[model samples]
Target chain A: MTGLADRRPEEDSVAMPRVSFTENLKRHVDCPPQDAAGGTVRAVLENVFADNPRLGTYVLDDQRRLRKHVTVFVNREMIADREGLSDAVGEGDEVFVFQALSGG
Target chain B: MTDAFHVATRKGLFRYERRNGGWQAGAPAFLGEPVSAVLTDPRDGAIYAALRLGHFGQKLHRSRDGGTSWEELEAPKFGAEPPPPSPANAENFEADMAARKAAQTVDTIWIMTAGGADQPGVLWAGTLPGALFKSKDHGESWSLVESLWNVPERAKWFGGGADLPGIHSVHVDPRDSAKLTVGVSCGGVWKSDDGGETWRQAGQGLRAAFLPPEMQYDPVSQDPHRLAHSGDTVWCQHHNGVFLSRDGGESFTEIEEAGPSVFGFAVATHPDDPESAWLVPGVKDETRVPVDGKFVVTRTRDGGKSFEALSNGLPDGPAWDLVYRHALDIDGTGERLVMGSTTGNCWLTEDGGDSWICVSTYLPPIAAVAWA
Candidate 1:
């Protein structure tokens, strides 16, 4: 069976998009800025969460949908699909996730 | 009998210790965070606290050395949705699809209870969205009790005070570890004879005045604000009135008269006597404040035949304190009881509600209180 340890070292050299989290979430769980490889918003977030699974819980609900008070913006435009998270992402794209100013 | 008690509040988890003939508050843990539930396992000295973060979702923490130190543990959560049914199986395809499509998440860990003495490392958690979870290894992990959640009658469950229905009371019968009774808001009472493998809707005589006249007596529609048990009898401070069930939870008889009003959210039953229980009486429905600006704790000793309003050491007039379901607790000896309210006032009774002393009046809105 193929495992993470068996992957080729060259695959790590590929360029990926940078994902950053809101400062408010740092108090609960850690989510430092990092680079992950993916083609869509869901894929990119999931890719980063693959290494830090606990961060995924802070951003998503049990149904794996983005939380009601969390918003994600790719570069400048906000992601259109909150549930499916199907917005496209390009190489070296800047993804910013922020907590909405709704709840106290 | 207990020297210490933990209070989960809107701001943090506070511990009160009986020191120098008075209860003293210690340094708060998780300061500036909302603690929804607190449980101190009687079998073991371990303490578990459930936090409901407004921004980061729900979290659970365990403290072994009282409340001095804590370790973060995975909170109870719902599992992934089940696979959709095939088109050939059209018996109840639409209903099945709709049920499956309505995804559920753990909005709040409303209550947590330690399993019976036989089950050492077991724990039970009831959460918002009306789901039960079991943890065999303390609070490290959890799994949904599908037997209770998948019941067909669960579709009728709806929200009461919160936006979604919540299971606020989980009572594990001391006589038998397998016998379990859980009280849900707007979902009536449910009993499981063989642990949580299966469940049945109980609480036969419960009535819901909020519903239409025709459905007032419906079993599944009754909203029990809190359920407390002592010995074989169960006491329920329902939304409409105070109901008592002598046979576990199979049936109930409403106590038509309880002090100034029969409506409240919290109930504390004596540990040794089934007929003795205490409830905080309040004006029901729209204005959930003290009846006529008089706050009192109503005690029934003659098995609901009569009740007395105990107000000594409490507020005299123009007081508004609404206690939540888990904010009232009785110690093992049943002599000492503590209660906190939404208005940040706490009272402690040393002589079983005959009188009470104000413990704290400046803490954040209290959610749950447990004797450690």
Candidate 2:
């Protein structure tokens, strides 16, 4: 029987999505590029936040809604559900987070 | 008189120290950021500064060793649960949802005060969108005071100068930590006798001239810009005029003899004398400049029976300085007072309000000043 360490590299990459944050956000909180496993935008972000709770505050509000000044994109397209964050995310997709231009 | 004071401004937090017999400003902390509120905890000398960042949301920092360094702390925040529907708007589900959404987020930390001297490490903060929070272990963590937030009368509170109503004043009775009072813009005043376990509307005589004649005396509709206390006597710089309350905040009597004009924001009450208080007067409403472009500080020594305008060392007419609600502060001795204005002007009065000296003509627009 094959163990976990014997899994192929391609299988690992296809099971998770890549996530990145705006460079400017580093000044306030640390958010490094990494891979998170989730099927939807909310699930992916929640996975990341589960590791770094402080970063979540800078991106979302008390209601768990994306902050008015923060924007998220999945696979180069902006996520339409800011409040519920119901947008779908595919494995190996690139998720980018940005601070809205108006906030600056 | 105190040897140091802190000034919260649009750009940063400034610390002014009495050096060589004169006050001198040191380098600022949080420079280039909007310092909304600064609390110099007299009990332990811990300084907490609240910052309102355009993109990062409200942040709080505490400096244990003066303002030399700071460590960011968790700011007050509401929970995920939406507020209970108000009876006044229960029929309109859409409007109720909008109100709950607006109340869930903290906009700015308007004011913070240390708990009673006995309750060390205890801190109380009031925030915009009108919520109260308490911290029992210094500034390490905070929890919302749900009892006050859920009061039925809060539904009637509306905005005065901001889009959402804010609790700008929190007065914890020096004699008893459990007894507390808070002043809200457009929400009159509320008092909690059991350390915030419960609350009730308290400002009975506050009047709102801007409202309809029938609703002018409605306690929930009154707008109290600020509240200062001298022992048990409370002084309110209301939207319409200055009011004095002898029974804490149960009742108030409008002071009709304020110098220049009765409309202004800041008020400093003498720590030792209940009858003595100071006010900065300006034209009311649309024109918020000094009355006729003349800036003045009004002092009432006889329980608001009369007022004396003191402007010996201040700038001449054509000066358009309007002091915010927390910009003027009186030291513990009640003799030294510092006042800052919206136009970046700061004045220091060493002998009460008899004379003043311009400290800085260009600092940032001042938000609050407190003796350290």
Candidate 3:
């Protein structure tokens, strides 16, 4: 009901996490816009957080330089300028997460 | 982690320990310091201890008739386990010297378990990428079972908890050798059938609760920090809290009875009974908290059907630090228990956690400890 109440036919939709997803490493977070304006990686991610606080920690950190284990790809190739927000974001970009991969 | 050390909960943790040592230090907790030891033969009141893995892995010191005298267990001909064949290994000083020490350190028989389980074979030394090299012939020539490596999920190895492919605990059910379980730091609990010939990821239901968005697996710990078998249920001090599994990890039920730190490590089970176990929570921030421990040892009297917090004599109020599972133990005598924490404190209970005592206050973030 909360999701529906927030929806407006004149506006757009957002991507939100579902409930009871099962897994201890989880927190409640809300939706992201289906379409947003951002020609850069940080811009799009920030755009995600702008509408959903849940997407904040999931994408960016306190220092906000991509965590070593976290990888962001543009067309399946790894990004080089992980720090700068100047990296170009083309149409239909995708993000993938892979933790630092600790232990043995 | 700076203060993490070992605590010999009782004379039942491992099959080696001096009869009279204050605070009962068992198994010489390593990585990289061990202090105040009394390795004894016990029968003839003969005390002998091997304090080789000492500071900087430099020398091997042995003591007879307690810590009153010392000897060295080094043989010129013997060599440490060979390096993993990395030329870069030479660049790493600790690696080269450590390799030499590990290879040469086993020349003379010091530990009672060196003679095998029937004799003195309680501690099973393991290596990275997960290998079970047993010294059944009394540390003469180590044999690699390679069974753990062959398990289908071998690729999932260990990296989360403690950041290493770990074979931390080797549990032998005296009633049945085939009924064995080993705790992989981050990969969770693994059970071997037919003497470790085959293994299955018994921690299926254990989920990563606070995984970072970038985290592919739970941080360094296997499903949780530790695994203890109580009847059909395998309880653990998970990355989340106390968890229970029935049907040999085929399914699970989380027991909400855990914490001193919601973000911590280590979980241990009692020796004789299925209903008993222990956990030491870790403090998250840079500051150290508490004295004995934040949330002390918690146990389920009836196999986790129910649980109660056991903080009778433990450090209470304003405490923070991560206490691992391997550091907590219930002695074989069935009357005692203990937990070693990163705060440089070891809490003891000779009455099954009904009460507590801060026995030892100087040990590292304890890795593993056993009592004989």
Give the per-residue Cα lDDT of candidate 2 at B363. 92
lDDT by residue (B178-243, candidate 3, tens digit) is 666666655667777666677766665565665654452332334555666655656666656666
How accurate locally is residue B290 in candidate 3, as Cα lDDT from 0 to 100? 34
Question: Could you tell which candidate, 2 or 3, scores higher by TM-score?
Answer: 2
lDDT string, candidate 1, B269-313, tens digits: 998988899999889877899999898999989899999999999
Give the number of colliding residue pairs in candidate 1: 0
Which portions of model 3 miss their true places by more than 4 Å?
A: A1-104, B1-123, B210-221, B230-233, B248-251, B257-263, B283-295, B362-365
TM of each candidate vs. truth: 0.92, 0.91, 0.54
lDDT of 3: 0.47
Deviation in Å, model 1, residue B303 alpha carbon: 1.1
Candidate 2 CAPRI assessment class = acceptable
Candidate 1 regions off by >4 Å?
A1-15, B82-101
Best by TM-score: 1
Number of the top DockQ candidate = 1
Per-candidate local distance difference test? 0.89, 0.89, 0.47
Alpha-carbon lDDT of model 2: 0.89
TM-score (0 to 1) of chain B for each candidate: 0.95, 0.95, 0.65
Error of 2 at B208 (Å): 0.4
